[model samples]
Target: MIKFNMAPTARKLVNEVMAVKPGERALIVTDSGRSPTITEALAQAVAGAGAELAIVHMSPRLMGGIDPPPHVSAAIHASDVVFLQLSYATFHTDTIRGALAGGTRTLEMWGFEEEMMVVGGANVDHAEMESISLKLTERLTRAKRGRMTTPEGSDISFSLDGREGFALLQTAHGPGEHCACPGGEATICPVRGSASGVLVSPFCIEHKDLGQISAPMRIEVKAGLAVSASGSPEGERFWAILDEAGELAKNVAEFAFGTNGACRKRVTVREAKKAMGTCHMAFGDSQSLAGEVNTPLHVDMIYDRPTVWLDDEMVMKDGNILI
Candidate 1:
């Protein structure tokens, strides 16, 4: 049970973050792992917004990538908008893909803690955050090539020719929309077989609960695939997860930077991954982002203080967005 007064925040999420307009059908999807306190609050807010609200709680998925039950999928298709406040996200599932294809917008609020729903990055000025993300996306979208390096031993180069950048701007003003509430990232998919070099992960997202890097990890990339990884038990786990997912899991999926100025360190990587001045690389599942790779697992590795260059122009230096 959450100890805080999350009603106001939940109302904000329903009214502002989700932009629930009058007479819209708003659906709340939850798993057994979620908190009822927050869920009920959201229900209240949706009713307050004059939208028909339905709450569905299902058994948690056995794995991350599996689809929800058929009834849940039906509810998703019937709704005008969906709010996923589940412990395990429904974003990557075919159910969500099908719903989006049918013009239903969604907000992926996965693994959000009690406090996060009320404060920190989750309570940011979303319009400003979206503006920042949009500006960076424009810059990344115009670039044909990119290079990134860090003082802690990271040097990677990749091509972005004919690829556009994406942003999770935290608003669903259009059809087939999907955004995370604490979202502010600008990401791009590297051209297949065009990425090569070494990435020294000083901090891994899987190891975030430790709150600091224990043993640094090294990921070696060749032809857009992570060929090998070394250092730390976390590093071993990272490799093992991808290895179990098969060949496509090794593909370099995304290169992105955080833009949420209000985010900070927490118990999980959820908020940290959105913190300003950090960058992350994801492997597996890039088909949605316009890359050729497709895998059930999509994992992200985070590191600090990156220097990024789009072709010859420096876009970010030492974790700071320069232009």
Candidate 2:
């Protein structure tokens, strides 16, 4: 495999985004299935910053939201900063919650490819993205209801009442704060049993069988649960995962829009979900983001150019931020 120079970005993460202080403990976590290039670069950056660094490797998890090994969890809790470079996301697991609650700043970098360290969303102006994300987050926090529609015939509405919006600014500057690398979304969890409508998406992120969706998938949601999914074989595969995971897996868990200007179209799902003007909805395991639901699964479906409304105000129209 070709080696990409990840040193620059890794240093940025350690020094700028994470702001590792001298003598602070920093941990880099990865799994067997993931490449170690990024992890090594991160370790070097941490050590170069005068921080005590630890690197751990384990077997890959079956899916997102699964917990790490006990020792790894312990290490995470002890660290001042952690970079999760696992094959699958552990963002929703109790381990992460425990780490965050203990004042460990974490950065989720699951499913990240080597090329991502050099280009794409990693090149985004984080400060500008943070500003945009915060603005949109504030709007979502104040709105009682939200509606999303796409040209592909999606129309979903949900109650945002009492929901707090989150901004993924790609930084973990303070204790107890966690963010995703290449993150630039303004997201919120809808009330349980409050989402109802059809959701159409061109593609979904990370599945056992379907990678990039072969065809547009239409999901029917009623009372916050995905009642049915169709329109492609990929849809059937998606429904199967949810059906097998049990009832809680079908909950309409998240509503979010991309904010990173550096993201390109038709890239990896990890980057695509952060592409400006795009939007996505997720199913299952939202407690990490302060939602009521919890499940072993967390999957996102992405669609392009959506018109979004908060309460009676149009916040985004045809992928443009109207404010």
Models 1 onward score TM values of: 0.91, 0.95
Worst 10 residues of 2 by lDDT: 201-210
What C-alpha lDDT, on a 0 to 100 scale, does residue 176 get in candidate 1?
Answer: 87
Off by over 4 Å in 1: 1-4, 59-66, 69-71, 206-213
TM-score computed on alpha carbons, candidate 2: 0.95
Off by over 4 Å in 2: 1-4
Best of the candidates, lDDT: 2
RMSD of model 2 against the true structure? 1.7
Best by TM-score: 2
Compared with the true structure, the alpha-carbon lDDT of candidate 1 equals 0.80
lDDT of 1 at 227: 95
Residue 85 of candidate 1: its Cα lDDT? 83
In order, what lDDT does every prediction score? 0.80, 0.88
